[model samples]
Target: MLASQFSSRHPSTVALDTGLSLMRVAAPIIAILLVQDLFSREFDRKLHLTSLTYPRPRYQFLLGRITAIATLLLFLLIILASLLAVLTTWISYGYTQATPPDLGLPYVITVVFIALDLLVVLAIGTFIAVTSTTPSFVLIGTIGFTLVARSYSGIVALLTRDSTLVGNADTYQSSLSLLGYLLPDLAALDVRMISLYGDWQFLPDDWPLRVVSTLAYAAALFALSVWALNRKKFS
Candidate 1:
């Protein structure tokens, strides 16, 4: 429907971009809900007590829950990506844009990056779920983290372009730069232009490093969650 309504000649590109943009927003919410159900709700209802009674160690339970949620998320991503690909292909039929989208490798890579982004969010939510006593904090913290991580780079870039537009722009930029170390700049993971324009130049020079850093960050969070769960004493 979005493809048919797109005013641009490249309705296929617009359609895929719009669909992906929607997925970017929706995926985090879905991941947070899964984390809440698998981890937060278990703690909230004291269901973990029964599950922990199993001979398996606490880390095993934590690992298994995270794995289950991640698998479900991956499956959903694959289905959505396939549907979007079909829609884009259908829209592109007959009409040819000056710059056709790759729709093949580039599209697959874009989807994989999105999956990584969701994994990072899931890991953060899982960590918050295990450490925070209040189950609600898991949702709040995860959403807050997502908002900050996704937008901070853009905010800093805007400030950098015109310091005179905002008073004390240096202060804001400096603060954001410092905070950047702790938060993954998820916006950087969005290499959709590579797929949208069918241009490898759209891929960032540091994209491989960014991917590694994202994976490392998620792994570290998962490890912390496991540690937190092991140390948590239930009353």
Candidate 2:
């Protein structure tokens, strides 16, 4: 009964923790690996040409795979979010001070942002997978890109803040900013604040800009992937 009481008092907190945990694990890692496997498996089995023979435009195949993978990730997120809603509702009902569970707009929007973020990761992974000769290379390259993309914002921030360097800070900052524009800023797509705060007030004022930037980055990566796949010659 003590555990139940604890849950009752902390359901929202628990739900917030769950959402962040799920996003951290699902968005940048598991989803990327799964998407990478889509193309890696084709190459591994030497079925690239055969797979391409399906009655569709070249880009159709790529779009279809991306859509399918994104849909699967969305489905998983829905399932997890639903379970969290149910658990939070059940637990919070017993406590007098507990705020009612809200898996509504805030929760749903967070899931959408996560889905979009995973879409970008999928594009990057797909590009790496199509360009790589082996599955190992695909996995390694995707993971490396994921790490760099996700952390690029932080790395730039650190460099721009440090004044101990002998170089002119303005020049360093401008260069870093230019480099950042080219790098995928995964940090922008993060919506964890909504999960924790039960509202969008905690989100940055430029959240929409972040979403637009992420989509643009995804589009560019996808274009590159299509170009690479078209040029790729399979044995």
For lDDT, the strongest prediction is: 1
lDDT per residue for candidate 1 within 184-213, as digits (tens), equals: 999999999999999999999999899999
Total backbone collisions, model 2: 0
**Regions more than 4 Å wrong, model 2:** 1-11, 94-102, 155-179
Off by over 4 Å in 1: none
lDDT (10s digit) by residue, model 2, range 1-235: 2234446456555655665566656556777667657878877887667878888777887778878887787787778777766675665555544344346787777777777767777888888887877777766777777676777677567766785663676676676677676776776667666755566676789888888988888899999989887787777
TM-score of 2: 0.79
lDDT at position 160, candidate 1: 86
lDDT of each: 0.90, 0.71
Residue pairs with backbone atoms closer than 3 Å in model 2 (clashes)? none
Clashes of each: 0, 0
